[model samples]
Target: MIDRRRSRRSFLKLAAASAAGWWASLSPAGFAAEREPHRKPIPSSGERIPVIGMGTWITFNVPDAPGPMAVRREILGRFFARGGGMIDSSPMYGRAEAVVGDCLRALDRPEALFSATKIWTRSTSTGREQHADSLDLWGAGRLDLQQVHNLQNWQAHLETLRERREAGEVRYIGITTSHGRRHDEMERIMRSEDLDFVQLTYNILDREAEQRLLPLATERGIAVIANRPFRQKALIERFEDHPLPDWAAEIECENWPQFLLKFIVSHPDVTCAIPATSVVAHMGENMGALYGPMPDAAMRERMVAWVGDL
Candidate 1:
């Protein structure tokens, strides 16, 4: 039976222990034995990545001032310290890529940094230039993944990405859309393109991707990265007054972020969920979803109904 009495504080304590490497020792069964952070594989390469990753959209777009930059550095430090792998950003987010470079430099370049960014320009030559600029901005020799942001001039940029992938400058290529925009075109790209990853917005409140994009990714063996898992804080503010459902304990969810994030990452085709946040406390809560039990299909259905009723 599940422990219904486990409060949010208790869950945080467990996460803190895990973060501090208290469970580093192996059990007699020859595994770490304690509940480790869940990982999902990239379908194209079969590479396993942690289900919870950091997103640098508005969150990391800070000025180079000492106080603001230091906060971002602490957030990045806590992220790597807590087993975060994929850090998603885009050139569209002003100064975010450069700030990420600052954080990496401050952290002495963490090995766990899975640098993922996008190309958001028109011409092939400009796309190439932007891609190179992102590399310099992030201080990465080669990007782990390069995507077409919002599919802007995707045809032209894709050609460049294909060449770069062949030239060993990028490990994977994909496209992304957000706020439920242009999914039909997104689906076409997913169907026709030989892409490795595709990112879209999916959350308890927004389920439009369920109809096509997600299943197509599964069919085509493309990894999925879910954005806006909290629906840009709209879902949180809507349910702040309401208490968590009693059954949330069944899957080890203690707060709204964990509850919502666990719902996204639990999807069979979702490789990871990139929830952007500037605050370290919220980042910790988001990473907490990486630990503990995830809901199965029946429970996910219940979650949908539970949130829909509110």
Candidate 2:
């Protein structure tokens, strides 16, 4: 019988080594230009960010217990070492925001950190309080991005977000939804609101955003942060027994994680895809998507059809 635990440890070791080797291969100029994973511009400001980013949802909602915190610290270390920047979390995610703070503190606070979190309450007063708590938890004087989680009382919170942005308390303001919920309302808000970003669930299997939301974001010049790139691990679990399509190599994908993430970030409208993982080895594999070649329109279609057949 296959020893799954042993296999996982071996794969993690190999992945870490491969990540180090990939970094060593880049030239100074390449590094300065940020050309390894490639970057996409935030449509509103034209500021570029790496296409692959880290997410702290369920993966980061850990207790203050030493062992669990150490694992999270290692995951954050691997993320920054691999050129990751944006780290998305929320007040809704239990202790995730606080855990992120702990991990960053242990890492001595990376300059590349682009912290993003959400205000997830109905009361504007509570939203303000929550936003302040998030900044405290993240140890950032000014948050890079603040979103309205699931569009909860977005109307009230967006006003405050705009005010904060104008005062330079936050760099960007936006809203979010997930699990394929509230697309119609999301679309209305996207049309009517002056948002710099939008977080939503989109992956290889969940293509509903492609029909309207993505195209509308492109038209409105809004940056898109794609969450659930692996559909909350459902995609991975579903395809665990299946082999990647032979043509996946055209995009330089060696594994399922890379294949899935590349599909999300390669879309024209997607500024970044935040894939969360508690495992350090999975972080390596996730960041690997940022390094390799990406798919074009034709290859993307093939990828879609290939996965659809299964």
Best candidate (score: lDDT): 2
Full-model lDDT for every candidate: 0.89, 0.90
The 10 consecutive residues of candidate 1 with the worst lDDT sum are 25-34
Regions of candidate 1 where Cα sits further than 4 Å from its true position: 1-35
Model 2, range 110-207, lDDT digits (tens) per residue?
88888899999999999999989998999988999999999999999999999888888899999999988999999999999888999999999898
Q: State, as a TM-score between 0 and 1, how close model 2 is to the true structure.
A: 0.89
Q: How close is candidate 1 to the true structure, as a TM-score?
A: 0.89
Candidate 2, residue 81: lDDT: 77
Q: What digit string (tens of lDDT, one per residue) describes model 1 on residues 84-108? A: 8899999899999999998999899
Evaluate model 1: give its lDDT. Answer: 0.89
